[model samples]
Target: MKEKVLILNIGRCAWGRCIFCGYSRENYPEPNLLRMKVDLDRKLVGFEGDTLKIFGSGSFLDDKQFPREFRRYLVEKCKKKGIKHLTIESRPEFITEDTLLDFDGIDLTVAIGLEVADNDILKKLGKGMTVEDYTRAADIIHSKGFKVRTYLLVNPPFVDDIKESLDRSVSFALQHSDSIVLINLLPHANAPLFDLWVEGKWKPLTREKFFEITRPYANNPKIELDVETFRFVPRFPPEKRANLEGVSSEILNHPHFRVWQEYLCDWYEKPKDKTIALFLPCSAKKPYSKSKTHTLIYKTIKTLPIFKNIHRLVISTPGVVPFEFNDFYPFNAYEWDERLETPEIKKEYIKVTKKRIFDYLKHHKYDHYFCFFKYSAESYIALQEACNELGVSCTNCLSRETYEALKEEKGNPLFKEEALKELREVLSKVKQKGT
Candidate 1:
């Protein structure tokens, strides 16, 4: 049995001149590429257990010269080969009744890159369509009985109201589509917008800010949100690095630390109390075995006299001990075994982790549980469910996956320079505020 994957670079974009897009910038041999892809499809046709899938970079339906022929070829081949699924990407302007007709009787899903719902930001990004365009396109796709997926870009550069923009975007997608794929903007070397970013004219939201904007949509059942990391280069100056170096130390001396200390005086912090405890995960444990932030938090909590009178808890995987904090609840790492090498073991580990958290929360209650660790779909789902069961408020930090993606994309020499400068400015502010 053999499986075949075919990606067609069908030329032409519906919204060809989008400022932030560069999909159509690449050169392509349309007919030749289609022939090559078809030949590949034929090669896999003989295999009894084979599957075939077709997709393209630009708007698949907008390439009028070749897309129709390719679609026909693909549908016929798929029908003959009993293919599992066929997928494609397009813009709102390209999705219409005629476009949907092309996929008739084919097991296909169409995805549109609806970057955002804010018209002003869309214009800023040079997107060629409006929210109305996406809504209409969604209706057309749904009417034709095809599953529709939308691509959403969060915290785009130069967006002043990042939170409001994301909120509106999520609301629009939830109202119109079945599933949403959320991605952070990753500027590439050849991308048109790279120059703007490199010049410090554009910037992605900070990690903390990203989480604050997306927290509301984290647990929505109607929409399936998948986060894709941006790819960028890292470029930070020496001064910026120096400023960020001692942030944790300075935070330890802040008033927030004082408030945390007062709550720690009490064994249990209640939900009705003014102070709320945040549970964070610590994965790094070696030598003395302590989380840098956890240690800093403990020190800060100790300084806060009000912490003794409020509710507090540290939900963590067993690794490091919290310093003299009796309110800490240590949950053994469900997947601690380095020897568990199989997929089944990993699945069991996740199941065990979910069960442990659920079981523990069933008996205990908290006022607010803020997750200040790497954001993961599984962790977010589990924590949300736990919070729901306890009837308490729960929130998670920004998706680390998104941050990593942006870092990879922004790491280029051009964007990196600007990021370095911003980091330096932020650090300077932090130092000034600290003093």
Candidate 2:
């Protein structure tokens, strides 16, 4: 059975201040109701799908975006087109008993953005609506004999454990929603979250992380993994953002996972033909650039000819961060120190780091892998184990004598003359090879 789905974008959303959303930036002062009707009519012409998803960038039920007369008009239009079911988006605040009452005869599924179940996390996201609001809307939707679909972000910002928080959120949303839509948070320009990303206060989940988080719910029929964040990429000026689109696109195209998958690949996929990769250890400071050790490393490395050609990556707590993203989110923000944590914590860190290394290796292609780390560091062990497992050899930029000397020290070993000399020699070889 080919489940035909037609998704139409209408008016711009209201209450656009959700820290993670970029829609509000596009929702300028305009006569949305008039524009929405024109957009709707154009899309609905000769409509041929079992399910029609009407997205107004906000609440489709809101009169400001879609007026009462337009609601009646849409109902007639859908009925005439023999549209079997209509899925429309709304904010919890805009969904009321009276609002649902307006579309009385239609088979409707009302979708609401309940990004996370935790109220504190919701507040941090600047979602504006509370759990109570969503539940209240869901109750009204149910009372009106409509289906409730809820949206959840896997590993949302400000969350501690990606898997745990997603588990809790999915569990909670399932109880209230007839269906659930899951998407990884995607950072976009103009959103408040983008600013956080720039400042190293937040980061969006990678495709691998998203898959891992949503895998538990894949078998559940009620759960819909919104792979659309990866597709139908909204265009933005090149100067603003190169490829990434808004988070709202994920919400709008939840069922079109293929489209989303392609889009995500375009945004996050690494260039596979790179000739050299330098895997540096994570820093204690937020944004490795701010750390004294990393600062010295960069300063020393930049003097080498190969530095201009090699891909710079950080072996960090969150995962492998391309040096360009060192200033973004968890890469820049996390303060986890294995030295002060419990054994279990340390074990988990090693496991996660190793898994990330494997994931990175699986996706990225590099002719040479050079690592600069304290010989005894957990990151080094993890990367070494991954390389060994994959039959890939990685050269260490620290000599055996230098590693033995500082194997027990707390100071920055990379700053030492021996370490610097080894780094220079190894990079010199790379430069020579490139020539």
Q: Identify the candidate with maximal lDDT.
A: 2
255-322 per-residue lDDT for model 2 (tens digits): 22222232323355554544688888876776788888778777777887667667778885556777
Per-prediction tally of clashes: 30, 8
The per-model lDDT (C-alpha) reads 0.53, 0.72
Report the alpha-carbon TM-score of model 2 versus the true structure: 0.57
lDDT of 1 at 135: 89
**319-361: candidate 1 lDDT, tens digit per residue:** 1123243322222112233343355534443443344455545
Stretches of model 1 off by over 4 angstroms after superposition = 1-6, 33-54, 205-215, 221-231, 234-435
Clashes of 1: 30
Model 2: how far is 303 from its true place, Å?
Answer: 34
